[model samples]
Target: MGAGGDAEEGVELEAVREDEPMTDLDMSRACVESCVRFREGTLKSSHVFASVSCPILHKLEEALFCFTANTTEDASILSSKNATPVVLPFLVRFVDFDNKVFLEFHQIMTDRKFRTGKQLCTEGKLEEGLKLMKEAVDINPTKAEFRGHRAYWLQENGQFDEAKKEALTVLIKLNPSYLMAYQVYYNSCLLTGDVRGMQDAILRMKSCPGRVTKSRCKIEENEQILMILKEFCVRLTDLEKTKNFYEILKICKEALKIAPYSNEILVKKGIALFGLKRFAESVEAFKEIPSYSTSFRLLDIMSKAEYLSLKFPPAMEYNRQAIDLLNEAAPERKNLIKFRESMAAISEEIKEVLIAMQNKDWKSMQERAANTKNLINSGSYKNERLKLQMMNFEAGAFVQQKKLDEAFVLVNEVLSAWDTNYEALSILVDINITVGKYHDALTDLERLKGMKKGVDDQMVDRRILEAKTKQQEMKHATEPPTRFLNLYTMLKLPVGATDSEIRSQYRNLSRTYHPDKTRHLSEAEQNDANNRLLKIQTAYGILSDPGRRNNYDKGLAALESRNKTDSKNGLVIRLEENRKKYPKVFGLASSSEEGIPSGSSATPTTAPSPESTVTSKKRVQQEDGVISPDKVKRFKAN
Candidate 1:
């Protein structure tokens, strides 16, 4: 009988009796028929096909879930224990047919929903797409492909936690051999910062019997790197405590061979190098740390390395970050609090000395510089670089106070120890300039150009030109022309002011000259205020752009050279007097080529008659040299 007819009668295969010797085809037909009855809710829980082997019944029990039995009672009924070898081949045949039917049914439904959902996602309807994708996953819960799409969209929707769960619980379980599920899991873990989960995914993928060879290789490489990190990263502290820096360095070298960009190992390497008294190499190692990996230990080690390298500002910042991390982690720890206070005091002293130098508070700068020097010498730091820095600052103070001999001595001493010391070189150059030793200033500038590590080639060239110009000025006793309205002068800033200083000065001047602040003044005063504000805006526009500012500086230098030439020739270049009266001819035109002085009328006083044109040409030719034929013809035509 057909399975549909049997299902209609609610018979649980009682018609197929055990005493009947059934063929393989008959037994296969019986199981599928019984499963169909269970799916339709017509099969009684106590009903069984007695002639079918137990293996056939077991296959039916497994297929019942895929077929979706009507109730849990129906599922439990299909769980049979009786077995016989006679129907085993028939049981395998039955399972293949059932799986084909199940796959064909689910594939059609799942593909339709998945394709439509992906189309919606491509069109940017993410919510609708996600809902349809969920429906597809629900239709085929065992299909890895369907669930992988859902997990990806969830990740795109920023539901990272949900995406991670879907990938780990469903996709990976369904298809552990494929790369797609593991890739989705690893990427989701990255966004959530679940680093350990990411490592787990990579490790699992390393053993996956994946079809993609490239992915498998990459996974194996990553697993090797993880192994190295786990081993070396943990031993860093113990090795450092034991002062076995050579061992630490050896571990770092081996680990770096496997994972060159690993930040943790790099930090440990820097610490080891620091402990080994390799300060320069330690600084190099510390510089490789990415911004995201600036942990407390990295910052603390970097602070010590930089301080020993004689970079005070960077050391201060690094120490401050370490202290801030400590404050956040455990503020009540007595040792940490004491350490924070001590480091903060040292930073404060350095900061005050810098501030004093910037303000040109000579006495205060000298005193603070001395205090910081004493602190460095007496405290744990016995760095010669710090001593050089102090000497450089003291030289700067002395130069500001016009104590040239002492300033020169101090700066020269700093240069003797560290010839490439930028601050000391700057002070020595300034001292040379003050003492009218232009030759020495030029020599210092050449030395600066030779040490090209941090030098801006353009800036060094400009400074060299400036030193030469100053030397020429001193030799000729000729002053630089100060009459022009330069941007620096308009903004009331020094010539070599930094970008931050320019921005700050612009804001202050803008507020000072804003029209709202000048509303109560006279109309003339208001007009002057408007002009000043416009000038301020124009100056800021040119100064804020690096390219434009560089060009403007070149223009200023050219103007200085021109002014010096004029002074040497005893020739005064004056502004035209008739700029407003004769705006086009005498003011804008080249008067020197036209042989027209400032006060002379450029346009003829009256339109010369044709008869007077000839006489005018003669009078012009006799008074001047040769008259242009075009001018005579134009006069005649007029």
Candidate 2:
């Protein structure tokens, strides 16, 4: 041996001599030192030494063996223990070893589970996929990615509520700025029709407090949100065709959550609410549109809603604003001008009706009510609430004039068509009281009180007391009249009849009641024939227009729901009464199979307004600051 070999041998002999005297504790400590050096790459596995066997030393040896052999599973298990007892001081010296091992194992298991879950979901095994996804999340609770996967699958499984809850967990607990979680939540809310939840999700995405951390591409994030809103806008147009005003409003609310100032969504929302007869809410939706908007459609719709809501000043202001925005050559300009004229006429007639009622002039009240009806029936005006008001006023006039039969007929028809019309119900109660039918009066009064809960309590109570007192003197009780004279009934068509069926039936009825056909009858009969023709024309006007027909259908549904005991028997009775009263006019003998009245030609026409009488489409452009025809055309083309 060389001198170097001899020197190494002498050192090993001395180390063995030193190791021989080491205690079990000392051996454990020495083993831990060896393990640390091995982990730090400062010592080779072959050179590592242990002098004696001990529990702690054994653990350290096992851990080092697994680490060297690349058996991460066993190493991870060994690390998850009290290092000072299990692996002596090895893990304590490498303080991050246990954590690092745990993290690696967690990542491996979570990835395996997540990938398996995704595959399962893609294979349509939702329940199994969901389980695996949940397990993945459990294995790595701090990672938002696992939770987001679980949430999306849950939504696909139709577990919307659970999906949203899981998504919230990611957004709130794991990752406050997680974008995927927000998208999952939004989709869940949308499918479930949770409007407020969808809105919240949209708002959160748009204004995420930690968006910088959540997304790398801000433009992509914004495009995603805008895409959602665009989808809602497209849905609104389809919903309009269905006349599902409620659904349209919900979609608008959701879209507005992402873009609160979207003019298109707001206008659609306003129109939907207006169609629903929610005039106040419609006005509120319209008001959200920026006042600087020059949209003619927006202003026109807002004006109509405001007018029906009885906000006359604002209604007129909106109309004038819309007019100022239009040119004389615009087709809508003519319609708008006619609309403004009709509004003015209706307003004047309403005031006159009120004044007549105040003055106890039944004739004047009836005439003004008739004028309002004529204006509404003219097709240029379209105020739903105003039409109801005029009907109530007309009935009130008949009641005050002591024409009880006429009053009864009108009130019954109105109530049957609009059972929740408090004004018509009140008029019916008045008629009952005027005829000394206290029982009927009491019944109507109680119904009114219930419907008007928390309103005019004192007035309702006084009326109830009077009705009860008068009941003691009543010896007879007759069924308060109920009649169903809906638009369908007026045209003598089935409830589910098609538009063509409606037109054909309308033509048939018009021909039967046309003055030219009924001219051979007596003068009284001819007058009755004219009245029937007018009613048929009004019915056609309502049923022909899709929007008006939808509103009427909705009203009919509400009426049926409110008056659950409504009977077709009442309609049969009313029809019989009509035949008895106007035998020569309504009887079979009066029916004529003569020519059909020209549908459009027979349509009632009002005298041309001063604005419409202008033969020249050209007007002074400077007046009202009206844009020129050419400019208006160009602006509209955009």
Candidate 3:
């Protein structure tokens, strides 16, 4: 049977949930954790999620209803209704988003809140846990954890197709280093009675070759990885064999010590940690993931960890980050951990500080260099681009704070990269134009045209026109042009312009400036048209013929290069070198191969096969360290 047909037999888009009561924490923390795994680039977690399409779609229908119900809130930021724990459940649902939301949603996501939200998912409320995970993913679609959980929940609920797709998307985002995603994906298929997916996963895992790590294996470490692999192999060797959670834990501990950050090893770590009783450590270990972060696993493990220790620092840290991240989350998408832990962190005074900090408006530029330096120094972001944007923000803040010199310094720093940024160029351009520096403005406009993409073309044109008008006003007006001027003007063909585009440009120019049509032209108008007509004629004459244009361009380039070289005052010295490359042609053969002298060998040997001919010929031609074909023949002849 075909793959799709076989998969059809395995399951349709059925909404099935395990009858056993899922952990209450499942919705909050687990869902968010899965999204992280998704963002971190796990595919299996996404694949397993495909199994819950019906439930996921149903949840989306509800989120849509929630979105439409709120009248005053921005469509960009949806708020949640607090009837049931919709945040966890809704977030865990499968949603379609392109793979490019990585940096765009940074302002909306918090790593801490995501962790706590996932803890709630693990508390046996599998349905609710999944929803929150799904929401976290919705807010920060770039996160791997959220997507992974969505996949896990879907697969558990029998939506394998959706789970598999989610897995693939995560893999694409994260690349193929994510073995955990594949593992979960295999489990999703295997759990749903489709053994083929598991087998396929195994095949893919093998064909890709010795784990993505550099093969710098100390024999002991290699043996340890092998041992761990063998232990995990038992899970598949006999699907019916009951696995001891402690034994699995022991195996992961040894493997982790050897390759602490290996994705495959980490995946093995997660599987083993799942069954261990020290659920908090296990959660931390899982959270310290290298690949395939399942939001479901994060939540399931997180809830268990919270139960293990409600006031743990890791859990608290999780809440804090989640709060910051959820700003961009959909309404009703709050994490329980974030909500409660954040309440604990906020005293009335701290809340006041947050409120006070929001009020800032500045018109004057910064004046202090120290203010600029201090502002830049305070930023802790590792990403270079983000650091730059934050610098801009700091500069703006300093300006509002009445630090003029600081603002200028900061703005100057920006100008270092974007010297002619309109925001910055306005400073110089306005000053130059006000002082009647028409040449400066024209020079600036000329340079601006050569800039990379995203330049404001219209703004450039306006500046150019102003510069030209100033130039005209400064110079005396020329008399009218003669009627004898050619219709074609000076032609400069664009780079890579096809023959068709060139022809079209030429035709358009030809029709516009024909002199007979300008019988009613004023003196200035006639002069302007006549000049344009001359340029058109020049352009057409130079570009219309292919050979002429090519030769002209080539010659011009050569002349320009020669002028540059001459200006540099460079020196050249010639050296005589033997031309050994033409051995026979130059009448210079090696001493050993000058002629056959006193032959030694007469027996002939069979010729080598074509593949070895080069090697055989070289072997026969050696005289001492050098190759001498004639010497070799005489030696063999004797």
- For TM-score, the strongest prediction is 2
TM-score of each: 0.37, 0.41, 0.23
What is candidate 1's TM-score against the reference? Answer: 0.37
Q: Pick the candidate with the highest lDDT.
A: 2
Point out the higher-scoring one by lDDT: 1 or 2. Answer: 2
Off by over 4 Å in 1: 1-172, 182-295, 302-339, 354-361, 378-387, 400-405, 429-442, 449-638
Candidate 3 stretches greater than 4 Å from native: 1-319, 322-364, 368-373, 381-413, 418-422, 446-456, 475-638
Ranking by TM-score: 2, 1, 3
**Distance from true location, Cα of 610 in model 3, Å:** 45
Each prediction's Cα lDDT score? Answer: 0.62, 0.64, 0.44
- Residue-wise lDDT of candidate 1 within 1-638, one digit each (tens)? 44455446553443557797776556766755654654466774335454456445444434433443323332233334232233332233233234444444345445666887888988889999998888777767887777877888888877766788888865447877645567677766654435477698776776666568335547765565456556666776677776677788888888776555556677778877776556668868977765523476677667666666545466667767766665555743344345445545655776777678667799899789878778776665455566567776777787777666566667656555455566666676665444444555676677667454434667767877887986675445445555677789899998899999999999999999898999999999999999999999999999999999999999988997887676653112211222233332233223432233221112222333433432232221111111123322332332
TM-score of candidate 3 relative to the true fold = 0.23
In terms of lDDT, which candidate is stronger, 1 or 3?
1
The segments of candidate 2 whose C-alpha lies over 4 angstroms from its true place after superposition are 1-227, 475-638
Give the per-residue lDDT of model 3 (tens digit) for 390-452. Answer: 344445555446443444454445444334343333333443344344555465555556453
